[model samples]
Target: MARPAVTLDNYDDVYRYYLDHRQNLLSARIAYAALSARFRPRVHYADGARERLQALLASGTRLIVVANHLTDRDQYTLAATAWQTPLRSVIGRTRVLAKDELFTDPRLRRAIDLMGSIPVFRSQNHGLRAVADAGRRMMDVSAQRLQRGDVLAIFPEGTCNDGDPRRIQRLNTGVGHIAVKARKLGAPPALLALGIAYGPDPSVRGSADVYVGDPVLELPTTPMDITRAVAEQLQAAVDDVRAVR
Candidate 1:
């Protein structure tokens, strides 16, 4: 069945709707179950990082999860990883940063919304300067959600890598900006780098691996500086997971 078009007419309202941290746990659990049934991925983490992450989640601390973008299915795989691992406790407390075009499909939007996702309009999509407003809204909303204690997951690379799975593409500073702004707004969340790797098949039933890095406590003052630091950390994590096979 064809899904209906996005009904929200006003861009402002649409952005707000996407920013809302509404987590439908029932729906999330169902989706997680489905993804788990399909993938059943193996999860890994840096030494002692898993226990530390679990402790943080147990303490109700909000986190910024950054990862490399390899394929479209990364979102589902992450969701399933969270469901199967200690990150399960954070399932309802996290908000995923997603591209705006994804919201155009009502059915997919509903599922993503249930999983607590915020829409992002990349500058490259609608002309670099033209979508500045949308980009700002995404950052503002993401910062606000972070301030509100919602864990935000972002793909700093912005787009998926089709060539070399090991090499990371240039990262977008939006994630860094959001983190800095969130701190200024009185909600400095911890940063965690997540690395996801899929088998050669790259299908739902393919073997997968997830690597979680240690929380980055020393963030740079400037957004660009922090973005660079985060990019390096994320790349290291990705390298770790990619070598698992």
Candidate 2:
């Protein structure tokens, strides 16, 4: 049988479906292998970041990983680079928030599902009024997943930054809301800012620079405040990658 389509109207059902779904290890390995073979980006880490990340994971603390959005292939490079870093441990345990359209293609959807991706109905794609309820539900689901010990990875900028690859775009407050909600649910996730910088021509392989920042254990209480703090930290990470590249 064909899988039921994911839509805003049926978001609650889809969310429930994800809650019961488990990532296939074999599928995840195959997907990561493909990503690694195609994108050979160099990975860089901030001072003490490597040790801190391992400690956090060892303590069972979930991560809310936020990264800059660059080209369409940014996620591929990010995943490939992550496989070469301490992040490899959470490959199948992380739930990535990806736009809804990406799940529309059957061939690509299988890989996304295997990678533990949750469909996000963005306001830009569905209109603010249309996505309001579904957006709130999505945030709730994300928080619940964190509480369940799943690492949450989000591209908070919501869209690719075409104007400047080195600078991070304004982040949406959704990530902040998700963090705050998860904390209120008794699951405070550590924040990890990952920065990705592509060379002048992003289309070329091996021109990506991926930087991982030290995890932020404590975040601001309010959503806007958390968003602002995340933006500042993300910009610093981006600068670090640009400096080395």
Candidate 3:
């Protein structure tokens, strides 16, 4: 039997309670795992999603899917599968690199921990030490997960952009760091850049399109190369999906 869905009817109270009980985000993870169980996600564009993801995972590529940040709640759609997919599948429980502030909330912190999040610091950029530390931490956590055969999905744009004729900004360096770090371990994971757009024109249905293509660039020796490749693939995917446009 299919599991029943959960509702946040009393979310405000629940949220407050969680905040009072926060403990280094450990409790948050358990709560999140429990809450995540309530959702039953269906892909907006299942057309090639399954096939593409399966093929990439089958190829023994520690997959890192760099998707453009969009407000259609794209990240959650992808994250749902991370904890639910088969062990050998690309969607197997993933470690996300989300903003640090989200963890400050007890309930949110729990969700992040349960979701297996890795805090990506965007502040303290005035010093190189903070930058290096953030990079090293990301490398350690993500690399460990990849070595254990888990995929990592990140939004290079960091946050969603809201506007008509949606826009994607320049790719972030974090994606590149992930690629290079994995490569240095002697088995570089494949970077899958995707462009997800939603529409039905005058009538909005469940219509959506996700165009995927070959890697923009293979694993590189340096982080810069990986970041550039992510940007290239992102543009390519968007074009491939909307080539008819």
Per-model TM-score versus the true fold: 0.92, 0.96, 0.66
Instruction: For residues 1-245, write the lDDT of model 2, one tens digit per residue.
Output: 23558888888787777765678877787788778778888889999999999899889997899999987887788778767777788888888899999988988888788888899998988899999888888899999999998899999999998787767888999999999999999999889998888887888888888889999999999999999999999999999999989
**Please, what are the lDDT tens digits per residue for candidate 3 over residues 1-245?**
22111113332332233222213344434444443354333223224654666666776778787777665456454443343433123322455666656656777665655555656555442244544654566566676566666667788877666654355776668777767767767667877666666554412333345544554225667889778777777766666656533
Ranking by lDDT: 2, 1, 3
Relative to the unseen true structure, what is the C-alpha lDDT of residue 124 in candidate 3, on a scale of 0 to 100? 40
Q: Rate residue 185 of model 2 by lDDT.
A: 91
Instruction: Kindly report which residue pairs in candidate 2 clash with one another.
Output: none
Whichever of 2 and 3 has more lDDT, that candidate is 2
RMSD of each: 3.0, 1.5, 9.6
CA-lDDT, candidates in order = 0.80, 0.87, 0.56
Q: What's the CA error at residue 136 for candidate 2, in Å?
A: 0.7
Candidate 1 global TM-score = 0.92
Worst 10 residues of 1 by lDDT: 1-10
Model 3, residue 115: distance off in Å is 2.5
